[model samples]
Target: MTTRTASARYDGMGRTGKGHITTQSGILTDQYYGFNTRFEDEPGTNPEELIAAAHAACFTMALSFALERAGFRDGTLETKAAVKLEQSDGGFTITRSDLVLDASVPGISPDQFAEIAAGAKANCPVSKLLNAEITLEHHLK
Candidate 1:
């Protein structure tokens, strides 16, 4: 089994707390995240954006492999995932993730592309991991 890990450290409490995140690959070493970064428009990363990035990357890679398995060799795929966080009765909850895909695959019909993209969106690890609603919109280029 393949497992990736990341760590987050938070000092202080509540809005005054400061947090740093680190990834196993060191791509995000000592990355800052906190109330200002999340609730306010501070210059730092936050959890929602990180989840979005993961979702986008996972879905795009899944689509690429699915396409190759279907005998398509060359193509380009770009995906953007938008994650929404809302205030729930208890606290805060992640409501949904919306994915937008721009794709260029030669000799692919709309119906075939839709089928493959839907499969990838449904089966991607990140998508399966989330409890929130997921939606996908794709454009053929």
Candidate 2:
């Protein structure tokens, strides 16, 4: 099995209670990484934005795989995944993920494009990670 590891160091005198987020590969990126309620539900960029980025990238890859597998000849494909964070019964939930896709497959019909988009939407890695319900509003144009 393969595992991906990333680490973050809380910046400051270790008392500031906040720090910059980094990946194992030395990628410096910050996510929603602090106490919310203690700071009016806001301090640093939160998990939702990170989740949205992950989902968008993952879903795009999935769509690419599906397209190649379907013998679409690997055309240009782009996806915009919108992960909606909403207030729920207790905490916030990612209530919806809208995948807007645009592809240029010369021989594939619109129905086939939609099918591939749908499949990718259902099987994306980020989609699998979330415990909340997912509502995919996909448009393969």
Listed in order, each prediction's TM-score against the native is 0.98, 0.74
Report lDDT (Cα) of residue 36, candidate 2. Answer: 52
lDDT of 2 by residue, 1-141 (tens): 867776656655433577556666665455436545123556665456667777888888888888889887657777676667777898866777766666777788888887877788788878888776665554444
Number of the predicted model whose lDDT against the real structure is largest: 1
lDDT of 2: 0.69
The candidate that achieves the highest TM-score relative to the unseen native structure: 1
**Candidate 1 structure quality by residue, lDDT tens digits, 67-107:** 99999999899999999999999799999999999999999
- When summed lDDT is taken over every stretch of 10 residues in candidate 1, the lowest stretch is 67-76
Clash pairs, model 2 backbone: 11-19, 32-45, 32-46
Query: Number of backbone collisions per candidate, in order?
Result: 0, 3
Instruction: Give the clashing pairs for model 1.
Output: none
Q: What is the Cα root-mean-square deviation between model 1 and the actual structure?
A: 0.6
